[model samples]
Target: MKKTFSREGVDLAYRDVGDGLPVIFQHGLGGDEAQVADVFPDRPQTRRLTLECRGQGVSGYGPVERLSIATFAHDIEALADDLGLGAAVVGGISMGAALALRLAVHRPSRVRALVLARPAWVSEAAPANMKPYAVVGDLLMRHSPEKARRLFDDSTIAAELARLAPDNLSSLQGFFNRPDPVLFGRLLVAIAGDGPGVSEAEIRTIAVPTLVIGHGQDLVHRLADAQVLAGLIPPARLCTITAKSQYRAAYRREFRACLSEFLETLA
Candidate 1:
């Protein structure tokens, strides 16, 4: 079922599916609930709740200056509270993972477990100015779908893009066009901003068991970062999948298998 909850005067969209232990799925920047559905479809015993962060998908955006990791974390807390889910397993991909980590740090009681898929915030070399792409993407999103598709395809981590199928590629392009252009730009800024620092100090404080998923060929969020993250968190496990090349195959099978195993252990 899909619903909306007000947070700081903006309405955020979310979807809940299946039935079991609550599991919240936070999508990456410019991503919506569908991304989570595409990744995990058969976990019927796990009640999945996927949220569309502010300025993305059907969610309404607030002031552009307010877009940041901390604000997003608060939005997640509000969504969880509205759903009557006091504590749930929280996991995310890319920017979403960063938000999940922040949620665990700030609202410890609300997160039972964590799953990070190709987390993209730990790098120091990420571009500081996203204005160029944001302007281009916003224009393409409204006027040129083909150009937008090519832009996204080219921007994806080369090793990861090689793994995706044609259909998955199409789905990704569709997602890019679903959100508002202005809001998407703000989301881009939010993603590029510094994320939560889950260092040894912070990791040690995290009581929840965590799983870090990485691809051997992912350049954006290198395997080394995953190793560092796993090493820092006492109860964390690292799962690495070998990718033939970027877009080679979404590594769907490996991702699901690893996630299932990790969740099973949580049980």
Candidate 2:
């Protein structure tokens, strides 16, 4: 069922499912709880919780000015505390992965382990900003799904999306459909705001066991960043999946296998 909590006076929405060790799944930009539902269909012993970050999903957006990773981390902590969870395994995809890393760095005690999927941040190399591209992509989606498909299909980003499993592809398509130009533009600004990247020093200090999943052909999050992340974290294991026509189909088995193995270590 979905639940609500107040963090720093801002309302946050989350979903709690199954029953076992607590595992929090944070979605990337423009994502919500359904993304988690698609990726993880059966977790026999994991109490999975997917968070809808502020400005997305059912979560209410407070002052857009205060939207930052630090604040999001704070809200995550608050949610965990409210649920009486301590040191839960935390993970995310894309920008969500970046926030997951931030939690590991800033609130080390709150995260028992880490799972990052197609993480967006690398050490020093700046990925080509895809905000403008995504904007155009979103615009195209409004006018023509064919153009949207064509534009993204030809690009590396489309390949990444296509690589996902059929269900995941559908979920992603739903997410893309929900994009509001004004909301998306503001979210883009927030993501591109002050804290654009994480420091190598901070990453090295993370002591929690980490699982890094990367797709070799991912256009949004480069493989180089994943390599740097794997190299920096002492207790990190890196796994790369081959790029497929669809991200879900191409990496579904590999991602599940890797995540299952990593979760077993924590068990």
Give the Cα lDDT of each candidate.
0.69, 0.70
lDDT of 2 by residue, 98-150 (tens): 77888888778889999888777654332454443344434443545445545
- Residue 191 in candidate 2 has what lDDT? 61
Best of the candidates, TM-score: 2
> Which candidate has the highest lDDT of all?
2
- The true-versus-predicted C-alpha distance at residue 181 of model 2, in Å, is 3.1
Off by over 4 Å in 2: 123-130, 133-180, 194-197, 244-247
Q: Estimate each model's TM-score.
A: 0.79, 0.80
Candidate 1 per-residue lDDT, tens place, 174-260, comes to: 544654654565466455654664444766677789999887654445567778777777888999875425443566777778888
